[model samples]
Each structure stands twice: as structure tokens, then as C-alpha cells.
Target: MWLPGNTGVYLPQDDTALLIDAMLLAPIPRGARVLDIGTGSGALARAAADCGAAEVTALDVSWRALAAAFVNTRLSGRRVRLRHGDIRKCLPGRHFDVVLANPPYVPCGRGAPGRHSPARAWDAGPDGRAVLDPLCDRAPGLLSPKGMMLMVHSTLCDPEKTLVRLRDGGLKAAVVARARCPFGPVMSSRADWLERAGLIEPGQRDEELVVIRADRTR
Candidate 1:
């Protein structure tokens, strides 16, 4: 996919690919209405469109990211509605058959990401639930009955917590896919701090990324 150069837009990475693979394996109904939250470069949105989704809405807080996604999706011959806004606030009252989220799960001491900056693409607060918590709480309300949400995050943030949150929200949730990825620059730089914060092992250099599938069975 074509991405903007140094435009503060997140380029697709291992997490994106993992999510795409899970999405492909999912039994998304044909012509499904799909929502791709935190769509960095529209990779997941394009994948959903290519997988035969009738309508795909891609949301990103970064305008640059949205522009990149728009370009990439259009280049792929997919019609995706690009929205520039936060996932928590955008498209109020909207529901979808499938919700795909590749949120920032990297544990950071920065508290929260700023409105602009590439760091916003992957810096979640300490324990990394800054975005994950809200997403889990909002997912069920955004999903139609029997709809499923596919979310990807790092184990550093506690995958079990995510599962419990989703289950408490009335979804049948489980880890559908997992990949052990070496520490990226951000994680590598913060390894010691993460260990000190008790978020990781003392010498841990790799983090496990898990793709969780939560089905709204109600």
C-alpha cells in the first residue's frame, strides 16, 4: 500500500498483517457492513472491501492517516468511507456486522497520545488500556446481534483483561490468533521501564500480539 512519507501516518506493520489474516479467516457475511477503527493505512478496510464487504467505514484520528487510507483504498479499487475522528466519538448510533480494530497497545508512560504525531499511532498509556478499555466497552454497542469484532493488541497490555472485559460486555471472546514479535523501536526503548512497571519480564525482548475475536451473541 502507498503511504505518506513521514506524514505522521502509521504504516502497516506485523500487527496489521496479523489482523488482516484473522479477518480473512473470519466468516464475515457477504455484503457485510464493516467498520475499521484506527485504520492506519486502510489496510484492514481494504482487506474487508476486497473480501466482499458491501460497505466499509474507516476511521482514524489523524487526518494524514485518513488521507493515506483514502488514497490506498481508492487505488485498490475499493470504495471505503474515510472518516477523520476518534473511534469513541465518530459515527454515533452506527452499528456494523463486523468491527475491525488495530488499536495502539504499546505501553507508554506518556499518559495519552497527543492529537497529532506519529506516536499517537502506537502509544497507549501505562498498561496500554487507554484506548483498549474504551474500545472494549464501546464495541458491543456498535455491533449488531451476532456481529463479531476482531481486535489486535499486545500481550504487554494484558490480553486476559481484554477477554474479561469483552465477556462482561456480553460477548463470547477468545484469542483467535497470536504472533510473537520482536520488540519494535518503541518497545525496545521502553523495555526497562516496562519491566520496572511490572508490565513485562526483566529481560523480555519480544512481545506476543494477539488477535481477539468477540462475537455479540445477544
Candidate 2:
């Protein structure tokens, strides 16, 4: 949905929104320092506040998206620190106890999200792991020593590869949950790997989704 001035994109669903639903399920510690990367619609940041996080900060490269997040925060009576920058280079000095991201996991293509999705949000290179890899790589540094991170992925991208990348980056990773729903923004090629990895049992399609959790190791 477009805001009044056409300055940003917005969506309202399940009261909390799509991105928020993913973050709300993350097991955040009470009074924890939290970071919501790619805070589209500001759902994650707002939900973090509702969950009693001691501090909440959200970052998105798009000014319009940031503005929308700010508005949503006020409307919901939730306080959050919002910033705009590339997720990797934006805030080098900030660290959080819990990092939540619902990055655009769809692989790069001419038709998807188009060529101008702020690069950081939907441009994940050939296998759609572009954004995911860097996020996983830098997650260790952005997180406090004992902090944990949670991210959402669809069957479209290489879900197992994402888990591997996170683990390889020194984080303890695991698939926390999975559900089936109508496909949104991924290619059909992802179906095979997901079933082969045991993430989706055989014969499950068109209605399954997955959530992954990774914990930073000391």
C-alpha cells in the first residue's frame, strides 16, 4: 500500500504486519538491546518495543521506508531509534543483544523488485544469497558476545545454504519453524533443495514456510 504522499510502501496484516510477525517469534531476551535491519514498515522495531526490549534500533537505507517506520512507531505508541544506511556499513559501532532481519531473500532477477530496490534490500546476487551472506558474515560483530540473531527465509532461496553460511560465519544456526503458505517472491527452483535438506518433507508444497534462528558464539 502507498502512503498519502507516495513517499513509502506500507502493508497491514495480522494487526502486526508481515515483517513484524517474523521478528515477534524470535526469542528476544527481556530488556535486551535489539537491532532491526531492513526495518521495512517498522514492524520488527515496533514489536521489539512491545516485547519489552530495553533498547530498539532500526535501520533502512531508504529514507521513505525510514519515514514510514517512524510514522508507524508513533502511531503504535512505540519508541524506536531509526537510521538509514547500508546494513553492513551503516553502523559500525552499534551492537545488539538480539538482531532481527527479514531481508529480501528472493534471488536477483530482472523482473523481481526491479533494478532499484536500494541494492541492500533485494539484491542478493546470483543465488539470492548476496544480502544474506554479508548479513551472516557481519552478524558476529554486530551482536554482543552472547547475543542471538533470527532471520526469515522462504523455500525460494537456498535455505540450507543460508543456514550453512550462518554457521560457517561462527554462529550456531538452526531452523526454528516452518509453515506452508501462498508463494510470494521466490523462484520455483528452490523446491528441490528444501525437500532434500529435510526442511520440507516430501510432497509438501504451495503452503510451507520456514524460520531460522542463529546464535552468536563467544
lDDT (Cα, tens digit) per residue for candidate 1, span 1-218: 57655766778888999999998898678999999999988899999999999999999888888889998999989999988888788789999999999998888876665677788988888778889999999999999888999999998888999999999998999999999999877789989999899888889999899999999997
All models, RMSD in angstroms: 1.3, 5.1
C-alpha lDDT (0 to 100) for residue 175 of candidate 1: 99
TM-score of each: 0.95, 0.78
The candidate that wins on lDDT is 1
Worst 10 residues of 2 by lDDT: 10-19
Q: Which ten residues in a row have the lowest lDDT in candidate 1?
A: 1-10
lDDT of each: 0.90, 0.71
- Give the lDDT of residue 127 in candidate 1: 76
Q: What is the lDDT of residue 87 in candidate 1?
A: 77
